[model samples]
Target chain A: MTDISAQDFHDALVAHKLIIPVGVPGAFGRGPVFEDVLRRFGDLVTEAAKNDTAEHMLFPPVIARRVFEKSDYLESFPQLAGTIFSFMGNDTQHREMMNCVHEGKPWGQYQQMTDVVLAPAACYPIYPQLTGTLPENGRLVDVQNWVFRHEPSPEPTRMQSFRIREMVRAGRPEQVADWRDMWLERGLSLLRRLGLPAEPETASDPFFGRGGRMLAANQRMQKLKFEVLVPVLSTAKQTAVCSFNYHQDHFGLLFDIKTADGQVAHTACLGFGLERVTMALFRHHGYVPAEWPAEVRKVLWP
Target chain B: MTDISAQDFHDALVAHKLIIPVGVPGAFGRGPVFEDVLRRFGDLVTEAAKNDTAEHMLFPPVIARRVFEKSDYLESFPQLAGTIFSFMGNDTQHREMMNCVHEGKPWGQYQQMTDVVLAPAACYPIYPQLTGTLPENGRLVDVQNWVFRHEPSPEPTRMQSFRIREMVRAGRPEQVADWRDMWLERGLSLLRRLGLPAEPETASDPFFGRGGRMLAANQRMQKLKFEVLVPVLSTAKQTAVCSFNYHQDHFGLLFDIKTADGQVAHTACLGFGLERVTMALFRHHGYVPAEWPAEVRKVLWP
Candidate 1:
């Protein structure tokens, strides 16, 4: 990719058959091509979901708070969690609650149980369902959902909320590893096909703040996490377009995802960020989406 | 689509290729196909963006509260707004703010001016940008972003927040209408190819309560609201997978989206729900993702 001014880059986008938004509220906001791309891929993905032996299930964005509690996510990563809830008292009661604070009294018991929470990760729903399954072997699930986290960075690198596409497997360690590796290869190739060069690097969920530094160091040391990198605005750092993760037995044990033979399964997961891929394409293919390479267009138009 | 018992449905999912959680949190949680579908669509979207004639740009999720004030979103839909703010104060003061009780003396100022709120719609950003330049013709913008609302329905019908792939046109009414019609056709074919049956129905956005009832009524009366529907549990009332919207300069005039001739431009948009399409696929195929059709497989694999 060559250095291009905002105007030059934008004009290129228009020429390439891309649709760009004039502006949005944030740096990570979306554009017209975004939907076009989603539906484009949706065609292929829906096919993948229907071909297999697994059932195709659609889940909601808000999961039961207790499910997250069981997964130890709260204990493992507190700061990153974007807890969602709303006040429920009627107007008069709500006014009374407000008045108590106005009078300088310690009003306790105002807040009640939290029934729903914004999902922190894309694969949260799969864990709970895996608990009561029979397959001693690994299985796959088809899902699409929004995810949330408290990211306060100007770098679109960490949007407060983002969409995550995940492929999760729970089975023997070797099977899980193989599944992750295969998807990783496909993911990288997809990026390459899109005309963007990407590299795989270590990645980690770094437990959480203050103490999370240790988890970060551990991930760097083990080189277990890998991400497909994409650079933004000529920055040396690359944003992660795809992630391959080996969660080991942490989730399997917690969710009791035992093998078909009754042994605890090892779990691994792979994730792709659709928008980030679009962003990388913008950077790699100049700005014009229409004039993209023939190979990229073939699959797109096909 | 026949009504399958919950257990039988789950078994079908397992047989079909769904990798379920031993115990899932909610009905609409995510899995492997989620990310896969997103990435696939993402590539095509970028292809479209590059080909579009307009320049592309990113936006922030946080909209200036004032923008909403000017747009009348807050007054019209207070229930849907998600305020973006922070508890601004020193550690001691922050602690006090946390302790703020209904009956207690109110703590120090907690709400500071953040100049932002969660973006309700993507077009609001375009209005402000167009104020400075009245492009004579061909004023168009394409954006995809995370949008928020307060619907509490579970699974395919509702989500607290989700991805919105939008193309907003700010030009002459004829031009905007032309763009909308083009997208409407393109979008329908895209969904059809995915094997998810969808129809283009005239549509309208529900403004709100009693007063907005008229808008809803108008939409139904004119068949302005078009939905692509399908059966998930059983083939009955189908879910609206996508919608075509014609704002008729309501927003253009409010935002002063003027053409070079110094006239309020006609504006329109087409929106896509990535998850809904995925859901439609799941319901159409079965819970197990592995059983998808060969045609669907060709799209993803090729």
Candidate 2:
């Protein structure tokens, strides 16, 4: 791997017109080359998981406000949620908001919260849909969705709105654990097959506040989360390209999902950060996909 | 054509689990069959447009606030814009917002407009990026994006957020008009082949207020917009499943786009509402894909 600085790689990608800056931190429009590779990588993932017999589901970026509240996401990552606001006002209110816009004042005051909030994760909505008892095999859903987190940064990988491809499994505890473990191995193998130096390491979610620290530590101790990290940004602080999360009945208990044996189902998910992995590929193999390694080319494009 | 009421059709869809109501007026999660048909139709559109040699660009559902403002969408459709609001505040503000949530009071005040707004159209962001001279053949962009509108209704077709697949062309007036006119025929033919009984009719956008009424009339008089309508929702009122718009120097002037000979470029776009067309298919050819006509199934699935 080329020992290029994160800033240098970002600048190089921007210069090559692979990532177009829209004057917002972590909200850049990906250029054609970046899109092509990202999509091809998505296809590779589909190919890898073709035989899983997972039921495919697609959700919009926004989730219902009630479901958002039900997830307790606000209690955990209060800072990272995106609530949609709209100008649901009368004619007089509209004119007043127009005046504010003309004066360059805050017009957001006139806007009210919509019934939806930007989905913080790909799997949040699926839980509510799986409220009843699952089949004997439980359930496996293949989903790819746009997710939002409010952490704006100059770092290219830390996008505010990004796509995540996930395979969510809901079943008995052993089934969930086995799936998570299988995915941990498969994810690493898949990434390494693409010549990425990916490794699985225990990780924790960025929970909010002092109480969150305890929860994070507990999660780590219980080995609830594992991430496949690659040194895309910097060797000192590798970025998470893939995550394997085992939510032992958290979603089941919340959504009242039940197992075939009439017990609260356990849940687990394997998420591939589409943009981050694409970035890692570009970083490792250089910005040009045509010049990428032959085996990588065959694996992605073929 | 079936003489089912809009409410009846909507109820049928919900009962069949094609669309899952999330307790929101317009926002609903589509079930697996609905998703399957939607994606296959997307593939059909891509197949039909493959020979156009258009550069495919995929944008996120959110657009930069500056670009959104530049589009003057607020001036035209102030009622139909969705703005993203985020909790960008200090710890104290966060606590206050949490208290508001806990008490079920208004907490939207704690949220502020981000640099991005919900993308009102699939092609809005493309114009700003094309702020330069075009080549001899101009530019053609094949874009499929999730778009937002603030109209909330129980009508199954009138989703607040939906996907639109569009082909945008920017060049001389003749070139733009020709592309629009060609797409008008092609879109109609494509829809007809799918047994939609689609027809092209003169149309105008729902521009805002009194001045907007004049503008809308002017648009219809100039024949600037045409919609391919299908009797999906009601027999008396056909729904627009495809739209062909010739924006003669409007986006060009706004974005400073020019032609190869240094003249102002004219722009035109043809958009297919993915959800509307899919709904039309289900309405015309039963809700179940397996029971659909063989020809239609072959066209969509094959």
Candidate 3:
């Protein structure tokens, strides 16, 4: 395990036919075995969270352009956002595009922005829906959707398009904090139960620029973010498989979400990187599910 | 039901809170009840198809740009393809984009095309994977993924981005034809079992321009495509809930897929529009699932 690098793990996964490479760096297809394990893990997560009466919603991978603008996501992480573009043109423009294709020139210039942007996170759209006052206790939502980022690397864990299963809570500050902490413990235990050496550590979003560095430091100092780490690619530098974040009132203020008491709602979310967790299972418990520990098998297959 | 139009149905869905309007036509979020019904319906589909022994594969919504180029999709349906664009620029270009954003100008100019395109169908990527010789019985794959088309309309069923569950088969001509006919019947039966008055009719892809019209007419004349139609928005004009297509060496020739006996293979696919079927259920049955017919409930929830 100590000798395994990210490249080695990626190659092994490809060789074993678990992942079908699409010739892109971080974008690939999951084979039957990989999809089976991922589906089971997702179901296991749903079972674990069934106790909480959270409203489940499903959104497509794209969000409205106006929502993306209001989220101020580009200002914080401009490099990572993916904006959708389509060829909204007439026949003449179409012919020009085809000519560009024939001539081997850049035809993307003819494409224009659509009304949507690839969603950066599963929980971003939920805030817009939370406008106005919430209930006294809070509002909780369960979201599982595809998210997009522009970062493309050879590491299989860092996929450009991936799925995130998230639980978002918006309400009073104390309630949000308690929920975040509770989920932090629950997420760690859930992963550990699956036989991964999972641990919680302070984390920060990869904010951009000089000011972003200061913000990252402040976030870390305030213990605003925690990630459950597992040695999927390398034991020396574990990958973050689960993230719990407390965004005090960043989203609440932006979306005008208020608590029943009329104060700005505090928000927190716990997200599980579905692919990373599945990869971690393959790494720790062997590629074959039948060879995995019986306890893990029961926990997943049950 | 006779007087209900597409807009009326959309308004009803939004009013019932089953669908969350995202300020964009043909794009919306599914609320809890809607999601619950959709999940159950997806499970029912999987259960019905389990006996086929098809290999299941999951791909992201976007596919490699090269694959899109090789598929000749743009030639026939250039207007309906979504080309993903990203801001792969430096600090200076980023500043320019922010300036455009602040000034309310078109900032999409700063974006560049990535190495991928939004997939137009669930089976497009599967063709590329079946490049070489197949087994004696050919190969069958089950794919369920998000697909994108650039058609924007007020009709909720005409979503720009939607999910499609497809079973793709590639082999000799007779084998392909038999599989297509088999699935066409299965699709009709499954929809009928759900208590929908479903029927199969000849169909054709919406090819572009005059040449495309000829291609479409020829397709219908050759009996290459059929659709399972149900009255969703209008009783007069039914909607296509499922599609069955037979590609006689179209994809096989492009991908060089050969049979085990050293001849070119043929391909066919049967696709179910998951969202459309769920919407049809809501349209046919009462908006409330509990009040729906018990037989329908038994089929879905079982």
Candidate 4:
């Protein structure tokens, strides 16, 4: 773990008046300082990706349940998924639900499943959207959106809901892999330029259950996933401020995405967790944005 | 009805390649052009609010279930609420759920209600965050976020999920009401500057069922809600692009927010439905951003 504790970060955020904690764990309302940093970080990322000519896209936080079902997400990480439930009950059932809530009893049973799911990743919606034949050069999309995960931790970096800025590329195998590698270097350099000490290493998703261990091992062995770590809450256990992932043909095959040459498209994405990166910057420099290192301020605010 | 049919607008979007339908009805993945316009719209709103000196805030799209319950949302608009549900099943129940999905059966029964709920409005999260005592000058927050409503329609303006850019103010009743009125005129002027025809009129939220009809009428009669409407989907029934609401200590009583003088804080909020505004812009000034009127283009892009 890092030298700074989660509690320290929390207290610092509260003390600086950068964040207001709701009574619920892991949820917060960010004040101007935090919002300023986050916005500047997003702008910097956008600036860095300017030359890529990636198609900028915005997706709703909640996605169609059918699209999510086709993502094969439930097989790997069911625990992290959130499904939207609605009250389809008649007046009698509604009254019963109210009474149950009034009596401090479970009323969820009265809610029925809706055709929506909270987006598990920033890039999840893009795959199904690219289900048709690609152009001769394939495509790249820049996405920034709120992503949801079920993990509720006191660690400020590990929020249940957070923003991710992602660049997703779909092309031939070599093209996708090369893009991932190029972005990995660029991402590290970019972080360093912003005055943050970041290092990239092979990583794996936090898959669930017995079968997931094998998947994680396979992912690591193939080096399909890499993360840029920064010392946030602890030095020993650095947080992943960014991740580079090569999905290869997994999504293309699922979505029936084919190149102009009629071959299955390969995919890669680089994702920067906005909140974690902001937190890392604050931890490394200071809570005051104006007082941050001159070079860092120049890079971010310029 | 609008001069342009919904079909016509849909065709224009597809023809311009500004949006891609994701098989799910009424849900879409916006492309670069749409994203650009949306971002510019957000910036304009930010610029408009600059003199208001509102603190910029960012909130997670999902909020605590208890906060939602305490907000008395179900009593008025339960039909529009989206509750987050998760599988809290044991191994056997998990297997059963999987089997049910495999067999195309309803498996939501296996899922339990989580501690979170999808935020129905961009301003909803701000109320609970301001629960404690207010500062001497009170507080004003500018929030832009994704919000969910259960209504799914072919009309582009009535999306199940959309972005709401909101400015919420809390203080004495006169302070809140005056701010609302000021913002109302400012919002209308800003939209007019964008070359969109807009008018302000008394409006009400779509409350639920029989009791809700009465509530909506009361809201309209008391002039508690007003909306800035522009003809997008229908000329006869103009769409509400921005809404101004005075909550007259309703949220204060719920969240225990008190002014420095120990009086309950009156709250008011102005919300602009970002997607609807963008839609209105396209409807009024053609779909091509580049070909828009010089004044409008300068106002938005400059």
Best by DockQ: 3
* Ten-residue stretch with the least lDDT total in model 3 chain A: A86-95
Per-model root-mean-square deviation over C-alphas: 8.6, 2.0, 1.5, 1.8
Model 1 regions lying over 4 Å from their true place? A1-27, A32-64, A85-115, A142-145, A156-158, A183-197, A220-223, A230-236, A281-285, A289-302, B1-70, B82-148, B154-250, B263-302
lDDT of 1: 0.59
lDDT of 1 by residue, B1-302 (tens): 66544455444544544423323322343445654665566555555456567655445444455555567564345455554333344545544443552224432234332334556765566566555345766566666555656555424335555566666777787887777777777777776776766765555565645566786788678655566555554555556666666667677677766677877777766667665666566766655456778786566445
Q: Estimate TM-scores for all models.
A: 0.61, 0.95, 0.97, 0.96
Task: Give candidate 2's TM-score.
Answer: 0.95
**Candidates ranked, most accurate by TM-score first:** 3, 4, 2, 1
Error of 3 at A184 (Å): 0.8
Model 3 TM-score (B-chain only): 0.97
The 10-residue segment with the lowest total lDDT in model 3 chain B? B1-10
Q: What is the DockQ of each candidate?
A: 0.15, 0.55, 0.69, 0.66
- lDDT of candidate 4 over A183-269, digit per residue (tens): 888889988998888999899998777677989999999999999998887778889999998988999999999988999999998
Runs off by more than 4 Å, candidate 2: B15-17
Residue pair clashes in candidate 2: none
What is the C-alpha local distance difference test score of each model? 0.59, 0.86, 0.88, 0.85
